[model samples]
Target: MSGGFFRGTSADQDTRFSNKQAKLLKTQKFAPELEHLVDMTKVKMDVMRPWIANRVTELIGLEDEVLINFIYGLLDGKDVNGKEVQISLTGFMEKNTGKFMKELWTLLLSAQKNSSGVPQQFLDAKEEETRKKKEESDRIADEIRRTRDKESRELEQEKLKKMLASAIIWVHVLYLKTAVGRRCK
Candidate 1:
């Protein structure tokens, strides 16, 4: 019978021990904070899920599953300390929630390129189109008003001229009749 002993590498053992120690220390230091953060994040995510889903899917034209996967990828990143940190989409809302949300919203807006949160070029183009349409409409309305005013002024002038001519003719006839009657008397 041969004596046999199985031995693993010391480096592997040290790495495993270090990882476990690091995890333990992290939990000890931030367990309460982590718990609270997770709870709050969960609540927020639940409340905003429907609206976010609708905006991402209908407005942004992205699939709900794709958005979920993208967010999950974002959350599954390592911290600066090189610890294996996992932030679930439903939990762990960090202090940068607003920033991350804004970034995601911007990404969605970029897909449409419309005015409400679009790129500068797209916004400018949309504004230009609206301005041109409004200017055209205003021009048409002003032209119509000017035409109508000119027609009204012409009609008034013609009425005045006819009245003046009739008055002068009546005065001349009355003067002639008076002169003829005086001469005859």
Candidate 2:
């Protein structure tokens, strides 16, 4: 049983085989080719599609078609497939039109609340109206807090000055009383 390919004390042969296997595994990893399909920019999105879809379903309870439509709109109507569809964005959105429009509008509005272009000058004014209202609210809150803080500090300083003046006045009164008593004596 000891005269086969692994006979006798062949430490050099054993080490050589182990190195060869290590090198083979290092050069030829057994990972799926899909992981490195494109750039790393969308690797997380590709990997987490299932998780995102599950969460979207849980939050919205949308049907499969509705979910697909919503996702389609979110991707700006671009096909998730490897091929790039040469259709316009408006056309793409039109293709997925259904009851999902309301939900898509809500989603897009929320996303573009902070930043994004409006459809027209009138729409820009409307968006600016909301932005200005929010900014005014924040400014008013900051002003109120700053005023309150200033008043509180001024009141504290006034109290401290009064206490110090009262102490000095008490000392002067005590000195006067002492001087009058000593004079009478």
Candidate 3:
């Protein structure tokens, strides 16, 4: 009746057997498998490290050590749940190298498109020249307007002077005729 009919052993023996079973269980957990996985990952990383470093240096413009440090920092970063998980930089690189290269090319293409390759000083000089040309055009327009206004005023003054002189002559002639008529009478 005792626990599957193995009641031949005494309570002390059973206790010893239980203790040994517990020890075996504790030792047989996933530790060995986890260690093997870690070793395999390390070997893979060793194989890929140089290639990854070269790509990062050539495409991303980072030194090998700097890139390694950055990758390690990212792998050590915490999740949104505030839990830290281990990551493999080599595995990440293996999976994303093509994507990284595509992004790098896109960035270079955009930069080439946006940049005219002109020196900053030359650009500034060109802008200043344009401003000066505009100012010169404005000055010439203003001067023309002033000259036209002056000519118009002078023409108006000449017309008034001629009208005044004719009126004075007419008045003098009329006075002479009235004087002669009175003398005759």
In model 1, the worst 10-residue window by lDDT is 35-44
Against the true structure, candidate 2 reaches a TM-score of 0.31
Cα-based RMSD of candidate 2: 21.7
Reference-based lDDT, each prediction: 0.50, 0.48, 0.48
Backbone clash count for every predicted candidate, in the order shown? 0, 0, 0
lDDT score of residue 153 within candidate 3: 92
Give lDDT for model 1: 0.50
Position 123, candidate 2: lDDT? 51
- Model 1 lDDT at residue 182: 98
The residue-by-residue lDDT of candidate 3 on 89-168, one tens digit each, is 33435444445534432332332233452334345677999999999999999999999999999988888888888888
Question: How many Å off is the CA of 163 in candidate 3?
Answer: 1.1
Best by TM-score: 1
- Of candidate 2, the 10-residue stretch with the lowest lDDT total is 81-90
**Best of the two (1, 3) by lDDT:** 1
TM-scores of the models, in the given order?
Answer: 0.37, 0.31, 0.34
Clashing residue pairs, candidate 1? none
Residue 49's lDDT in candidate 3:
46
Residues 69-175, model 1: lDDT tens digits: 55544433232111122223223334433334544434333423333433444456779999999999999999999999999999999999999999899999999
Candidate 3 TM-score, true structure as reference: 0.34
Clashing pairs in 3: none
The most accurate candidate by lDDT is 1
